[model samples]
Target: MEQYAQDTPKWKAELFDWLKSFLIIGSATAVIYLFIMAPYVVQGRSMETTLHDGERVIVNKAIYYLDDPQPGDIVIIHPDASGENWIKRVVAVAGDTVEAKNDQLYVNGQPLQEDYLNENRLKSEAAGVVLTADFGPVTVEEGSVFVMGDNRNNSMDSRVIGPVQLDHVVGRAEFVYWPFNAIRMPK
Candidate 1:
């Protein structure tokens, strides 16, 4: 009976040690994730062909703090100070001109090769719609970057929201981790 009693205390001590270790490890992981990287879910089809709706992606939050977001990198944008975060691809940096004419896109007066888009969708240009309308030769201001979605005609991006200030960018999204088979680095 005494031997049985000693065994119970030994088992309890082992369980207590495990719980403490678990709590410490869990807390550390949460802190690291919160400060360094974050997971985001695609809320819309704005980034289609590159990132789809309902996909899970990891954002490298510490990157922009060390370097500016270059054109071609997909970034999470904070539309307004208090608005919900949105995603878009950086199309042009400061001093660059972005324009659309005849359902074609140009950056710095050179045609942008948008191989990611389906031409049929970009052809939907109703009159007076600025999305694919002829405009600009407008130079982007300092400290801001122009952004657009991969699904050109369907996304509400810089063409609609104006330039995204570098300060308003959250992070660069580099990997998709969800849906198992769909997991891969976005081009």
Candidate 2:
């Protein structure tokens, strides 16, 4: 009985040390995940050829607080309060006029280039179909911008839901971090 008591303090000390280390490490992880960045999984082909389903990436949640979303930025947008988010590319910012007609993208009457797309394939597939449909010459409302997926024909984005408020955007993703071989900076 005396031997057990003598060892109690040593055991308690070791347990306390472990718990303290755990708490500190946990707190740091929580802070980084909640405020700095978050891991997000791509859910669908909406962002295909850019972000694949099941692909994992770290979203820099602090980015928008520092820099406004810009055209060509790949961002995660929350369409509602359900916690579901969509990843898409910013096509136009507040006050910009945007349109998709006969397979061409136009912003403020100037052609918007999408180097990520295979021009020939898109032209052939979207021939006379107007994949994204047409609109605008209408200016994006203040505090909102237009977004879309690289897989133009398959994505439902600003063209369907209308320009999204900047506040609805969660963050911008710059790279893929999953599946090893597919890991790299996203275009």
- In angstroms, the error of model 1 at 106 is 1.4
> What is the Å distance of residue 173 in model 1 from its true position?
1.2
Against the hidden true structure, what lDDT does model 2 obtain? 0.85
Q: Evaluate residue 152 in candidate 2 and report its C-alpha lDDT on the 0 to 100 scale.
A: 77
Per TM-score, the best of the predicted structures is: 2
Error at 136, model 1, angstroms: 1.7
Worst 10 residues of 2 by lDDT: 119-128
Which portions of model 2 miss their true places by more than 4 Å? 1-8, 119-131
lDDT of each: 0.83, 0.85
Q: Write the per-residue lDDT of candidate 2 for residues 132-156, one digit (tens) a residue.
A: 5566566799999899888777888
Task: List model 1 lDDT by residue over 8-97, tens digit each.
Answer: 877787898999999999998897686678998988988887888999999988898899898789998898978688989998999999
